[model samples]
Target chain A: MNEYLENAKAQMRKGVLEYCILSVLSEGDAYVSDIIRRLKEAQMIVVEGTLYPLLMRQKNAGWLAYRWEESTQGPPRKYYAITDAGRQLLAELDTAWQDLGDSVIKIRQPEKTHSHEKRI
Target chain B: MKNVFNICINGIIFGIEEDAFKPLSDYLEPLKAYFSREKDGSEIVADIEARIAELFTERPGGAATAITIADVNAIISTLGTPAAIAGVDESANTEAQPCAPRRTARRLFRNPAERYISGVCGGIATWFGMSPAILRIALIVATFFIHWLPILYLVLWAVIPLAKTTAQKLEMYGKEVNITNIEQSVKDNSLDTGSPVQTFFRDVDSALGRFCRILLRIVVLVIGLKLIVAGLMLLVAFIVWTCLQDVLFRDVVKWDFLAYEEMLRHIISASSYQIFMICSVVFILLTVAACLFWGAQLIRPFKTGNRMTHILLAALWAGSAMGIVGISLREMRHFTNPNSMSETFTVPVTDTLHLQTVSANMKLSNNAVTGLYFDKSQQRFFGEPTLNICHSRNGQALLEIRRRALGRSKPDAFDKLAGIGYQVAINDTLLQLPDLFSVSPPDRWSFQEVHLFLYLPENTIVAMDEGVMAHMHSNAHSRTGQQEYLWRVTDKGPRKIK
Candidate 1:
């Protein structure tokens, strides 16, 4: 049961981590702060450190884009949002997620032959 | 408005505002317009946004309270494209978009952090993906202990800005697009309400404060380190000195205890005693000097501390050393002069004339022995001698003072009065003084060679003896010399007063 639970959590992570990040940005052209707060609220376990490195990796992989804005307090601020590539990849991930979910549900489902045996 | 949707994305739950939802639905209309033939664009946009709001509100911290555009994106992502959701794969349709820097999207980051003075050192190290060690070591070594380094840190802390706005700090990490922290992106790090002059003054004030703190910290650290090193060295020095105590002080005093006393006895002298006494005093003086030097080590780097405290400690050390020397000198005296009374030099040759001379008429300071006594008169074959003298034990020689006439007419009553009149007084013997009193030259009859004929008993002990040969030679010599000065000893011996 523990092994099955572990696999379930792993499958959830691969499908959800990127969607979760993009979901935060769909609010607006949000900065890193907005994303972390949203993720932290959802118990996403995303840290500022972990998030930035991942963001940088994704940006390199062409799933992200950014722009600069002048700020009064410090030097300048950068805001980020998903591009078409991010949207497309998120779509592909959604289908893959449904398929994985069905497969896992079928495995955990009670056997049809055992259903009649239990009813007696 | 009949349907209210709550969106929870990544567990962040917030309600989808109808006003915010309307704009997002309007923006996705263009994308849905491409699939208009296959799916109802308005219906698809509405259904996706409702699901997005539901998920936003489903998040843990009431994400339903405020809905951002990012919420709509998550729902769209879940549903896929209009073509994909309407039962068509998006394999070929999504290919035309190439990832590029977004000119339309604004980036948010933490202000160039200045809240922490040296945080620049820390922040830059973090931002550039560099280790703090490399920066810190290079700075310290390069600055040669810069007096202004701390000030620089303070100024940096006050002026550069802080990462209070989540957007600015993220900018330091160079991430802008797809940032989820829009609400945290509020508030520009620069003071929004203050005037230009006020901001300038604030910067200057913080800069000065930072400078002072850095300087003070460095100075305190340096001084503390110096004190610690000096204390360690002094501890080692003290240990070494204590170990060498026996060797250092063993031979400081040098005198044959018995020989000194024997010389003083037979010669009726105090010169040897003085020499021995001085040796002991010198020994004590050296020990005190050594101890003082050792004590100074207790307060190593004493020169750097408070002047008044240094002076006070120095005075205390000096006083203690002085006391030690004084006590030691006093104790040393006992080794030279001990107490015992038996061997007295008994004067017996009463029928014959016996005279003595003290080489140096040093004062007979020892009070143990009193004046010398001789009662019976001697029948001198020559002219009757007038003055009687003796040497005292404390080194001073004395003579019985007498009245005399310089000249007189032949055997007259006036001569009798001037010469021997009623001036003579009597005691157990003539009242005597130290032998130095007879340094006067006789007018015509010169003193001849000394005859050592005085018989003193063997068992007798005397502190001064000048009754025989020494007495005669000194008298003859005095009678012959230029009368300006007196008793001059030819050998290694003591001399006397004029």
Candidate 2:
């Protein structure tokens, strides 16, 4: 049961990881480290290395664009920003998220189902 | 202390401990392979490397301190496994089982970490899954029977590549190439926990390595100490020899009457002699400095200014050596063409001709110096001339004085030969020849030599003095301690008339 829960949690995180990254960049441009930091703060991702492929995949799909920014401490930083298509997709994802949350909440309310049956 | 290697990652350089590099490289290699199927995969790897570089730079000591294995482990944990990085659902912990030993074909590679010499025997042992000690012993035992085994081992040592990387090390033991195996091999510090004999050999190998390292250090220290002592002694000896040339050469040693400078001046031109002395002194000083520097380095290793100092020293040494060689070549020209001048003095026709040698009779403690001597009153260098006897064709008695010397040219040789001084006093039938001949100053030595040839009629009886025995040629042999010996000049040359 614990393995099943872990699998489900991993699957859920993997599904929404791209959405969370886009949402973070939709607010403003951020380099990879900053994005990783914010995502880690939100508990959206565990490892920083996991974010690179997702970012690359999103950029290849035209939802994210990146630019090289000079870094003071090390090599140049790759700053990612959401594109117009990414913003449009985030709006659609926002509605989908709300609808899914409502469905889940409605499915969770057994008391409402019992009260409806009592009224019947 | 662990060895540190300078590694460049994403254009930033860092010093990393030798053991830490294996894990770090193993983590990246699998990640690279996992991502290679995607477009811009190399770009993703580059980004990850850049991040790693940034993380390394962000450490407390920055890039100045060596990156240890703990630092590498922390980075690896932060980066997660390659599968997780590739968005795979599988957890790293679930897949952490040790790789099963597979019977794959193994490639031969020199196992440098477990080697006694070039790791050939260890490599062969690993190939056949046996203890390296067995193979090493076998090779040693076989070497006595087959002399060519060592040559073959050297050939194999040159041909085989070292198992430097984790993958090659795994391949050497025929382990399957997978993420688990690579990680295991990297983290496996205690490698090859095999049979008891193998473990024993492994323990012995490490112990021997430690022993050899200590022995090498002790050897270096001993050599350094010896060099320091030898260099200091040589320096002191050089100084003493240079400063007290007269006391060392004349009084205390009585080896040579001429001083060091005087002896050098006799062999080379005055200008070249000065240059030679300067060059010799500089060379000795530079050599001593080099010896001291290297000795100190060996005893207590420390960094100096830069490679420039070493280069400067080597340059000075080579320059001095070249100067010495150039002066020697220039001086060699003086002793090239040899010329001889002969002077003949006719002797009275007599059946009995007395020959005697007049000793220089200089006041001395003892006759320690041979062949060459110094005349105190004349202040000249004199050498003993050789005496030879032969029959004359004219049936007349004659004494011939042949002075030979070398110079740059034939005329120069003749001019140098003119410097040779020899005198023979003829009184009635007795000829008194000085045992020593003198070479005048300003001409240098140039291999000056003198030979006296006594030409006499057949059956002429000749008597030689005891002092002339040392100067006699090998053709004329006489027993020592004898006052005199009679020699008859016959048609068949001089025969000793006992």
Candidate 3:
């Protein structure tokens, strides 16, 4: 039962992880480790394995592109950048996420109906 | 260690242990399988492997000589397990245990508030749920047994973080760092203020502690540097001396139990000499290595094997010493009996009997032989026969030549002494002697010596050539002059001829 809740939470977070990755890449290009570090700093991702497939899928869908950058310390790193399609996708996901957040807040906190009514 | 396999991941090459390579390869297989459905799956796996290689290079030690199974396991932990990478738990992999919930493990943190020598023991005791006093007693006992235990403790004290914050102190003792605990700790600290006297003593104690620590560090640095230099010079000297002995005197020095190698071999076991040499060499090497190790450790602490290593080294050193002593005693047995060989020749008493040396051309063998030179004259080697003029026992004028050697028995020593080849020719008044004594090739060089005793009558005179004066016996009263002086023996001992 606990495992099911964890899987459900993981799935919920997985959806927005893509939106977050696109939003980060929209600003500038980043190495794969740099992206993982940024996501970790925000407490949005758990493992590095989750990012590779997501980045590959985004690239396959023509929303992201990556190039190899040589590193002085060790192996060359894969740097990812957002294509125009990824920016468009990020814009659409931002609006949808804000709407879902507001609806969830309204449903969960019925005592805030007065504030909700005033805002509407 | 087992042989390592050379592997190339991406463009970099690494030598990995045979056992670690299998698990690491197996781990990558699953990663490949997980990404197989994607178009660029192999590329992703390659990139990950390259990253794994990079991380492996950054392990505590610089390069992986033989990557152990532990190294592979550590890499897996850092990169996540195969099951986590695949996101699908396969029942086939028994190692796919779910990652445990990340709980704060009690970290070792020195508590300055309760410190006695960095509070490392206190921190360790708290972490292990033991009383600090018991741990301190145990550590003291271990330090006595293990010579480097104190240094190891100091290194840990330098490395482990201090528990400065309340949360860290709570973690050190495995206490829950919640709001209640924090509030209670704050309240306790505010209420329990030490007396002014206690506070003053504490401040003085910490100040003294800091001063001692700095002083110890400076002393260690200076002494360590000095010892390191001394150790290096000793090592170099040892190397040079050993090399010279091994190379330069390989055939010259008869490495036998006694003087004559062949004779000793026939009399006693030859292996004892070899054992003695080996034992001495091992003892020297172990002592030198210990010195170098200690000096290096003082300069910079390193993780060395525990007490067992020291015990084993000490045992080996003792064993070598015993081996040397046993073999040396065995060798000394060959010299128990002494013997001498003497030849006497009658000579007519003259006013003066001059002692002169034969030319060097006659002394040098057709084949070149190298040995220690006894004087400025390169022609005379240490084993070369020495001529010492002494008074003969009888009142009659005569010359006696005695050669000496040692052996296990009387006859053996006499036979060995007889092998010394020394010759003197009487030409008119001049006694011509070979510049160097020759020991037969078959005879071993036992401290063999040649003594030439020329007996003089009460009124007879004697003179020595400058060439043989260097080999004169201490009692021979030969006066030194620009031209060698002759000495006349009257009733009142020998007097210089004016």
C-alpha DockQ of every model: 0.01, 0.47, 0.17
- Each model's backbone clash number: 83, 0, 2
Instruction: Report the error of model 2 at residue B412, Å.
Output: 3.2
The best candidate in terms of lDDT = 2
* Pairs that collide, model 3: B384-B437, B385-B437
- TM per candidate comes to 0.19, 0.58, 0.38
Candidate 2 Cα deviation (angstroms), residue B113: 1.0
Considering summed lDDT, which 10 consecutive residues are worst modelled in model 3 chain B? B256-265
Per-residue lDDT of model 1, residues B1-498, tens digit only: 434556443233445666566645543443333333223434334334434444454545545255555655654454443333322223223333435433332222212342233456655554555543455556656677677876776676666555543334445555441222222232232222211234554565466557757887677666655555655565555544445534654464232112223223322224544554454444444444434444454434344557797577656555655654665464344333212111122333222222333232222221112121111122111112222123334332223233322222323322322322122122222222223221112111112111122122222222223332233324433333332332322123224434
In candidate 2, what are the lDDT values of residues B278-298, reduced to their tens digit? Answer: 888889899888888888888
Q: Tell me the deviation in Å of residue B273 in model 3.
A: 4.6
Q: After superposing candidate 1 on the true structure, give the runs of residues whose Cα lies further than 4 Å from its correct spot.
A: A1-15, A111-120, B1-498
Error of 3 at B498 (Å): 7.8
Q: Which digits, one per residue and each the tens of the lDDT, describe model 1 over residues A22-79?
A: 6666556776656767877886642223354346546667778777766553334457
Candidate 3 wrong stretches, greater than 4 Å: A1-120, B1-226, B242-273, B305-317, B341-344, B359-382, B385-395, B440-443, B474-498
Ten consecutive residues with minimal summed lDDT in candidate 2 chain B? B363-372
- Count of clashes in candidate 2: 0
How would you class the docking of model 1?
A: incorrect
